[model samples]
Target chain A: MTINPKAKLEETQDGTVVYNFDPLIVKSHYEIDYVHSYAQDSEFFKALGRQELMGSKCKKCGYTYGTPRGHCMECGSETEWYKLPNEGKIHAFTTCYFGGEAFLNETPFHLVLVEFEGVDSLFMSRIIGVDTEDLYVGMPIRAKFRRNLKLNPTDVYFVPKA
Target chain B: MKNKGQDVYMISGGVTKFTKASPEADFRLRTKKAFDYALNDVGMTLKDIDGSVASYFSDHFQRQLMSGIMAQDYLGLTPKPSKRVEGGGATGGLSFQAGVEEVASGRMNTCVVYGFETMSHVNTWKGNEFIALASDTNFDYPIGGFYTGYYAMMATRHMHEFGTTVEQLAKVSVKNHGNALHNPYAQSPMKITVEDVRKSPMVSYPLTRLDVCAMSDGAAVAVLANEEKAFELCDNPVLIKGIGTGTDTMRLSDRPHGKVILLPNETEADYKNLKYPGVHSFRAGRSAAKEAYQSAGITDPLEELDIVELHDAYTSSEIQTYEDLGLCKYGEGGHFVEEGKADLKGKVAVNPSGGLLACGHPVGATGIMQAVFMFWQLQRTIKKHFKDDALQISNAKRGLIHSHAGTGTYVTATIMEAVK
Candidate 1:
């Protein structure tokens, strides 16, 4: 978790100093990791494994969330898991040409904000089986799940529901 | 003038030249320069400041913490109340508001609010990742919803709903950059056309590279005091007539997404319920502007306010803010800009300091920089400091500063009036 304080620095013609760190040394000294808990929505992903789109609805206000949550933000009521229809529409979308390391191989991919019929909030997912130029708002879409569920949101995507 | 007992005045303001990077300068150097400049502007020293608030988004670059204490120690101002404030990109405005509260509440007679950012130490990608830390990692990051993508989605939705065009968004950049031509402290002052913005490399769909604000390294400071001390310390003080802050949901998905357009004959209630989609920061800005205008007794912002400095992190944001701040009706942002209404010579001058589009956005410094621009503009001292007369808004008596941070989650709006 420490970088070398004495790393060699090189000055470029533009008067910018570039620090050169030994990758081996740097990697040996530090490790980046991610940790999380899914105690609230373990069932949500398990349902996704069966190609079922499940959401949570507040008992008080009947507000439905696309991404299942333990509590409803609007009514502060505990939510009950419910099955959502696979069909939805593209509320908004963008084709991102740049991303982090995890998405480097998926550069220039289309990310769509999809709104299920009667859903209160929108959820984001990648759009597959559709041409980028053909994407437009209000275009009908349907949830497309991966063969195997990894308990990650990326396990589900959307495509043109023709 | 309407808010009697709750008045806060800005005695002086200062800023370091915004640039792509400042490898040679660290927090200590940047804070010292900005602090000294602020003191010099008011002909006062550190001894005159009773409290201080420092704002910096991250210490990763400097590997330092307790920026307020460090700033106080660096300036040799000890045993004084000091604190640090951070609200992502709105850090400066929040810090400034803290200083205003400190003095206005009688806890301190005079206070200084300073904001700095040194992001050049890391590579561009790493820096972008650091910026992305502002988003909800569980949902946004995994889906590639970084700042550019977040705004790009909003832009796309705005275009889809309001028929806003790419050229209309480009006009914001063109106008701001043209304004920056007269600002020496701006990072990019080149004259660019709407076509140039359309041709720029795409970062996210509908958001070309030129549409985004430049990541910059800079620092800014403003000195605030109660009405009595303000008049005693400075000859031309800018009265802080009103201040407001608001927030929305951190996760973009939690908010409304589909388009909500308002008809021409719609009522305020109808516009509120119909036009706002809840995804953009317009709701937060509306809440903040409501509080600010109420305190300032500003019934009409487009008429009463002489100038405005919006947080144009991207071109689309500025256009959206116009509608959010009620400078124009909903969905008229694109036409407002295309018709030259937001220009320097237009009805209400916006981002006369070039805004973040051309002035550069150094995270923490941006809010204070906007305030500093307004301070100078209201004081009519732009020619004296920037040595440029064209950028000055003639007879600018009142101005407003709007800044937002996170994914449109935090917003701060302030109304300032010239008081000689």
Candidate 2:
């Protein structure tokens, strides 16, 4: 049985549709296009457009992060933008056979936690062009950037280096 | 707030049957049913409730900003102090502790903690998106970081670090779902085997569909009071021995490799090579357990705790939590499950109520349901509440209820003792 939301209820002309009667199921639609801001982390996303991964470094503790951070988590000091190497190693990964609505069409994808040599933490990203069974820990990987950027995290991903 | 030597007890409580969808009922109706059942269980009325703490996970599910207040008004808890508490999946556990604070502080004689979730309002995929919104939306969500993928990554790391086998993870599903057979309120009751679990369609690698919990709709109500008020309300009030809450970095990668917070029986040597709280373990859970055990005067949790109802949003998490709660050595969780140490007849019975795997993960109602089950278990009234003795542990003296959220960002542990 097919149900249509814009069926136009005969009893009403107020742009309403009923899916059921016993419980009176009504179809209500909601959608939004948020004008989001990256704020202080704007530089990190913008850097992806330049083929550069920008990590944050604590000025006081000399601690480094693989991902963006505005302040030092350990010393509570303000951080500065630091350039991250293009190549890194896969710390861990998993194959997601199911995902959210945004990524449902791209199901059965690989999500990896990439670790850097000098970085203190791992960075989450997708590993393209790699078979799930072929993926393993300590695998050599390099960051890949999209030619056209949208200031989104997906603009930067990881691929096998060699 | 500390207990401050003022004892608290869960005098009465009630829960609605969990299901995949309940289009006929909304959160308000569910809470009213549970609240009425709780009040009637003690032969009390709405007048007995001095205040309340409402718990639910997401406004996206209910599509109402102040759904808690709406439920409060529906319950006729008007003119009373009430506030909403949310810690993702730990909302129920946090609300229970909030009510405990109300009674223990001598502020209110009786406090009600009610929790519910109405996830059926959205499509399942959209519901996943709503839950994924709880992640670091900027970082994780953009890279196709589905919630299960995070857990799947952790499970993979656990497998790599400790050689935890897929069969071991499947054992958890088999055990938990089997226990749900006697639980009349459970959503998924199955007599499945490890092979059946392995054969189920894979959601993520190594995690079959059966290994995951269903999004459920239900509500639970727990009435708490100080000792004097507890006695006046009902007989066999279960004592709230201790309650503890802990948190970690919102992002898993941001967590530092800090030293393990040792329990009474554990030492630095137990985790000498273990890179403390890597993706393989839950550090906040251990912190919560450490504090809860201290006030409860518990030394050896594996032996001291008769039953533990924990957050098993996935089969693999149950094994990892066993290690965090000090039920086994950090890297020996797989062996613990393989040896049947967490079985119904084992040293400790974990998730005898079927946990989230079988009973379903109603988010906000899950932890309160755990406490309600523990309330009945400790009072030796499992026969009455469950209508069968299949899920009961013989001579259960004490039980621990755990609630967790995010990637172990927020965790709570509440210890309950029976009044012998």
Candidate 3:
């Protein structure tokens, strides 16, 4: 006679560990990695590895976006790559003592919005090699590219122009 | 926003106590509790709610997709048409507007808007990362663009251009936290002085730890209905007079400089030389407020509105919104706060419920919390809710509620009046 298949069961019938019991709370873990193309804006990150700062210029509005956009903000129009100057002036800045998990260990860092000459908008990056007290708006700053690029925005930062 | 549609009224509202972690109940149960309390307040039941709009900032915190559906099921609101809204910090405000539209459009006679958030799901640091995801993931997030960092930079520019001082920013913390002392549901109520705020540990420059709102877990509910049903449902009905929504580019730097959008109260010469909506100002907030006022038939907000419940994610932004909402001219917010213009006794009481700063910002729940507070304030029921008359805006007739997201991306300005 053929025996019926049996379903397997855990040795312990207890469920996942309950962190709390008043309302029955349990731990739920989640994490994931994302792989997505930068698409039209890929050129900006590539230019950083080549020691070049690239932005986008709207073909219709002639608005040069320093932050590099795929389209213009004033008038919705496709944009093209436009090379940016290495040196710019600080438009706004802050010294952060607290940050996200990715940058928490690197606390007390300066973030600046750099405005290039003739460029209508600003670009943001970290400012190293200067004290918080010394950083000021209108301070001349220049971009510094990493020799080893991680293909990330942090690959390019700013330093006070000597 | 005209009166072409049926007039909508906020019948009743309720909220759960705000806390860092709610061990007594999960997100869905918290919402149900708020819903039950709201229904009880008006002597109604779930059967009275025609539909619902759910608001929560992120699904990552709850770790549950279709959280709104789960909440609907738990609240016994299933099989009724329902939807969820996610708009960073503005989710609650957007959800309120969504429910109002339901009744206004003749689609439903009554609609319930509920919002909740469990920010304590992950560790504080991981939660910061989750909040940071609201920024452009590739451009801004990659450079460690924390929300605090963005506001700090903006606050710094405001200081540079307008001579705004850290002391002025500190006073905002003192004002908001002090106001929270009267709010039972407030998270970080303190009788803090400017010195205490200045001494608080720094999160970002010019913004001390006390200047920032702590993330928390909470839920709030607002029941809305048409004019006919409003009177039948409640004794003191508050009309939803006007609604406006505005948005800016996701990237802060992409914002283009333009002429100042004139509010009904201001003249062009008042800001002829100023470069509008710089990092120092929120252009989207101005746009939203302007539209709200236009629809509400308001000529001047500071003079007409009795109170304002605005998003104060940071102390500095509270000052910025004062200017955006036409309470004061641009570059005058710092002085306005220093002069005690935002106090309960001021021309128009601001954040009588302690706002996001002291009320505890639970992402999606914050805006609805503001609405709940406003509804109580307008209904002259503040003493009923707080058990004390210490926080009521005396003779409050009209008020405004502002919800903002990101640096200045999405903002909604909604005006409400106590309809006689």
DockQ scores of the candidates: 0.35, 0.61, 0.76
- In model 3, the Cα lDDT at residue A48 comes to 91
lDDT, candidate 2, B1-420, per-residue tens? 354557899999899999999888889999999999889989989888899999999999767899999999999999899999999988999999999988888889999999999988778888888898889988899888877888888898899989999999999999999999999989999999999999999888878998888899999999999988899989889999998788887776776666788999988987787787878899989989988898888999998999999999999899999998999988898889889988889889999999999999889899999999999889888888889998888899999999999989889999999997
Q: CA shift at B379, candidate 1, in angstroms?
A: 0.5
Q: Rank the candidates by TM-score, best first.
A: 3, 2, 1
Candidate 2 vs candidate 3, TM-score winner? 3
Best by DockQ: 3
For residues B1-420, write the lDDT of model 3, one tens digit per residue.
655389899999989989989877888999988888889999988788899899898988878788888888999998998999888989999899999889989998999999999988788878888889999887888888899999999999999989999999888888888888999989988998889988999998878998898999999999999988889989999999899888887777877777888899899999988887878899989999988999889998889999999999999999999999999999999999999999989888889888898999998888899999999999999899889889998889999999999998999999999975
The runs of at least 3 residues in candidate 3 whose Cα sits more than 4 Å from the true structure, single-residue gaps closed, are A1-6, A10-26, B2-4
- Weakest lDDT window of 10 consecutive positions for candidate 2 chain B: B1-10
Across residues A59-98, which tens digit of lDDT does each residue of candidate 1 receive?
Answer: 8889998777789988799999978889998888888887
Per-residue error at B64 for model 3, in Å? 0.9
lDDT of 1 at A117: 84
Q: Candidate 2, which segments miss by more than 4 Å at Cα? A: A1-15, B1-5
Chain A vs native chain A, TM-score per candidate: 0.79, 0.89, 0.89
